[model samples]
Target: MCRMARPRKPLLSRDRIVEAASALVDSEGLDAVSTRRLAAELGVSGPSLYNHFRNKDEILDAVADAVSAQIDLSMFDESDPRDWRAALHDWAVSYRAALTEHPHIVPVLARGPGRRPAGLRVADAVFGAMVGAGWPPAQATYIGALMRYFITGSALGSFARGFVDDETAYDPADYPHLGQAHLLAERRRQVDEGAFETGLRALVDGLSVQYELLAPGGTVRPAPKRS
Candidate 1:
């Protein structure tokens, strides 16, 4: 009585699990992902998912990290001679692109790196680049936090989507300046992308001034005490 040979390829893997979960989140939002749903999607028993992930939160974390892994960090390359302003402009654009693609995962990713390696790498690259450019350590940390807030806030929702498409929605009496507000929904992509770029440029420009004001030795001057 010979036993049947095991299949050459396993039906489930960590990568496979993450891919399925990420797709679910992308298509149906984060709440759509569950261990049972994943098991069904993967053509495996519900309990089998436990072999790869301890719980749905773990799976979601993996999915979020996978999204983080897609972000471009080359702009922050140590070998690049680009100044902090240039590097930040490039990095913020790349960061926004990644989050825009996986908007459903933005909430998870916005929670900071936690223990996720890919997320940590992103934070490290940004902070290291800022510090290497002569920003004080505290300022470098603040820069990282500021960029995260800006990028993640931009990704969290669509400004265009907030407007109603009906031309009557923006009454001429109530919103004289928003005569074309109804058109925004039809041009969601353009409006959103343009807004992101405009904000990014303004943010970097403002930071550039602050960067130049850093005192010699890379520290900011303390505020004067009131007499």
Candidate 2:
């Protein structure tokens, strides 16, 4: 008697390909990930990977989205506009912490923007928060861009520390304020962590003043006469 072989499971799936690519990026830097490499990692042929993803860029987009999924958006709540500043600072801090875990993927995020859903979702959330707080479109976009630059810049600096040494050896006479700030930062027990929050809040508060000035009929005050 002839017996039918057991049904075979599907040989490939988009989810499986993306997950494997994500793993590669998490372990190795973005430069280390490739379609051929992913296929080999997945025990499949290079062409088989194309059946799911068009090319390396497509795979990268998928991987970025996958990384974004790991983020918890509850860090920002629509219920409170007053804490929008704290919410945003917390969100950025959490994102920095999260990226630190996957140092390899940080570069990909630092470069690519439009291709991934997660990145867009974050932009949307920031804009939405600003709008909910009654900020104009331009102001919201400006704040979002500023925050992006600060967080990504810090991330890249930390990531590149091995190469840069990240030391600030300045004479007190030459940079007294800088020296004072450095000493104060060094004295704090949670300096590294608290530093980001402190700077973020100060940045947001400064921008809020600008937002008010840019509003209709609001007086554009010149720099408060510097003493």
Candidate 3:
């Protein structure tokens, strides 16, 4: 004659808490994530989350770094030798793909790794790969920073949003070059992807040129000495 309360759903923990918070941010943007809302979403008391995270900021940091963890860092981990340019190109593509999946987190990521384990791992992998390929330590570090700057900056906006179908927006009378600007919106996927590929190749090529001059045949090989 006692009606027991329905078995409570699995109680929340750090991973579940982070997962729910991440879903919230992905759907509604970072501003929408709050301790109260997160607690409600998980059907737990607000104070319970504190047992796992110190505050909303801590949770947000975890969510941001979760994205960093998704990147493919194997190029640095593998024992087999790889062409530096090919390794860099593949890693950048993987990094870009991971970042694009969580575009909402892009702005917060520029806080610069900030002691997050996964974020630090990503930076370490990139720098190690460069240095292992014969890049001078200083140059390797700067090149890593340069790639991060380009990838994160590009993630801040969508190319599709930049175009307008309205021909009036690009009047030939005022600007001749932008006459086909309206068409860009129709080809957003192609244009955005194409632009990233072009820029990445330019960076790799330019770096290769510098490496050849400094180290000779390529970044990893040394020039022959005159007899």
User: Could you tally the backbone clashes for each prediction?
Assistant: 0, 0, 0
**Best lDDT among the predictions, by candidate number:** 1
**lDDT for each of the candidates?**
0.90, 0.71, 0.86
What are the RMSDs of all candidates, in order?
Answer: 2.9, 5.2, 4.2
Better of 2 and 3 by TM-score: 3
- Sort by TM-score, best first: what order? 1, 3, 2
lDDT of predicted model 3: 0.86
Local lDDT at 146 for model 2 = 85
Q: How well is each residue in 1-227 modelled by candidate 1, as lDDT tens digits?
A: 99999977566899999998989999999989989899889888999889878899899899999988988888888788788899999988888899999999999999998999999999999999988889999989998999999999999999999998999988999999999999999999999999999998998998887877788887776645899
Kindly report which residue stretches of model 3 are placed more than 4 angstroms away from their true locations once superposed. Answer: 1-7, 215-227
TM-score of each: 0.92, 0.74, 0.89
> Model 3 reaches what TM-score against the true structure?
0.89
Q: Which 10-residue window of candidate 2 scores lowest in summed lDDT?
A: 158-167
Deviation (Å) of 129 in candidate 3: 1.3
